[model samples]
Target: MGIIRTTVFTGLLTTSTAAAYLAARNPVISPLAATDPIWTSSVFKRHNPSRNPATQDVCIRRIPLDKIRPELLQREGDLALEFCRGVWSGWGFAVQRKYLDLKYRGPETAKQLWTNEELAQSTYDRGTCIADHFEVVEKTPTAITVRCGDSPRKQDPRPSDGLFVISATVDKQREEVELRLKTCLFSSEGTIQGIKGPMPAWMEEMHQWYARIWSETGSWRLLK
Candidate 1:
């Protein structure tokens, strides 16, 4: 009787442990996920003189994990990294060869990780716009944030002190994800000193176009 009871107890313990492991590995879906892609933008705001004018654009899309290719899902970071790569390539930005390779600083299975300690830079629009470096500032199983520093347009009279931040989040339960891009234009001097003239209409239009492209097709292109 003692031997039978011990075996039964061991079996129950093993089953319970397996159930807990599975639950921990697979997170539940988030409530914020939507049925369709949603895009939104905010007017530029300056919180400080040293900081640049901040503008935010967000795109949220529903992507069922079961629908995605199994191979791509296994990669984990591929979706977010691919989206970043696509955006730069689509915008005509070329990352310098020296910064092309990224070395992540954290464990492979870490929910949050950082990359590009060497500071990768990219140039766009015939060297008119230069981004100093790319850094993975935040990461998690469901979210990631990429930041671009020392970005500025050649046309701007002030020095290049602006930056851009791009973030992506996944909601498994809702079967959706969200991508947000925020651009900040800063000046060495105070915000008052930074202003030379009104922003050109063409520049504003170009930014709007880029936002639209990322929201509509660029974010999901890799999955296809």
Candidate 2:
């Protein structure tokens, strides 16, 4: 009887430990902030007055700061910038090398940004291909916003002449910090209407996949 009781107790302890470990690995996410202005104001509205914009929100992860030193927040900010810039490449997406120059992070001067040029090669995905221009319309220590639109050089407007905005923000509250990514899609192009149902679904899938990739590999790169 003693031997059997000891074996049962050991198995129970092992199961409890495994459950606790799983809970720690997946943290809960809390609300961080309202919709940003770039999404609300800048996207496709400039080109098509009647355009209705759609937003997709992805709560990447909530990081616990209790064990980490306070001074590391600056490092976190830099990591956030790197994550934003490298996300597309890190995900192994098909991207044209020429347009990669538009992924700048810091403050931008008039000439240094892609305010009036096409974003990247036409070989990019359909939604991305419509992004003719990109500019760093907003930048701060904790947040960065990139605006995308149609080429200013074009005389006639194409239905694809819409706007897409990507914003990354770091919000710290008490013992935890939240990193969130928000994207807005505004398109006037007639072709987009046909793919509207699948566009958002695809974007959400890509966003979640990138988040997992960042959590597994990119976050560790920051620590190194």
Candidate 3:
């Protein structure tokens, strides 16, 4: 009943706009019960660096599952991990993990939030606040993917590490609930570069406008 904590995870890269409206009026976004990803040995290996591909920066969102929010469906009963833990407790994702604990995608991933050690990467575990230098790889109950720990900081055209993908599925003939936001880039001579961050095109259009409002209002605002 108190598993899901708050703070941004996907399609997020900062903590500015007033900490995303105070993480959108904080209710801890209920709807827990969709948690997994505390493995190690670093996995998810897929690189294709010919130039630009990872869907050329992407974002998609949908939510309907009876318009959500009955104390976020009470708890873990897996509705695609309760819509991916209600889009990792939606709304501006704790100013996008406080903008990666102020790393801002630089100092080889600055503060390393939740640096694991069996969930010392806390936000009370499970629910997730992202950023232990991005590593999840892939989780189930719908989908989750996180990657990055490869670069030593090459600097070739800018970008270094890659992949920040999220997925949650449950269409059930359109009852609704589908979320995907991908920002794949890797070109410190590594490869697989999407949206090749040569840096400064308004910071790649403000990180594709914060990954399209962190995927259209952070997982469709869990029943707005």
TM-score of candidate 2 against the unseen true structure = 0.45
- Reference-based lDDT, each prediction: 0.39, 0.39, 0.46
Better of 2 and 3 by TM-score: 2
Candidate 3 per-residue C-alpha lDDT over 1-224 given as tens digits, one digit per residue, 9 for 90 to 100: 12222333332335456445433432122111124121121431333334432223555566677876655444533443444444444554555555555654455545334332322212222323245445555565555656553432322233455656566666679876666665555443445434434445566556665565555445543553
Q: Find the 10 residues in a row with the least total lDDT in model 3.
A: 25-34
lDDT of 1 by residue, 1-224 (tens): 32453355346436756334323322222221333121121211221234333333333444566644456456666566555554554322322322432333223313221222211222111122223344343344433344343322122324434334444556677775555554444343345443332235476445544444444333444454
For candidate 1, the C-alpha RMSD (Å) to the true structure equals: 18.4
| Poorly placed runs, candidate 2 (over 4 Å) | 1-39, 42-49, 66-82, 85-135, 148-174, 188-221
Candidate whose lDDT is highest: 3
What is the lDDT, from 0 to 100, of the residue 82 in candidate 1? 51
Model 1 lDDT at residue 1: 38
Which should have the higher lDDT, number 2 or number 3? 3
Show where candidate 1 strays beyond 4 Å. 1-49, 91-160, 193-202, 215-217
Flag clash pairs in model 1: 29-173, 52-185, 52-186
Q: Rank the candidates by TM-score, best first.
A: 2, 1, 3
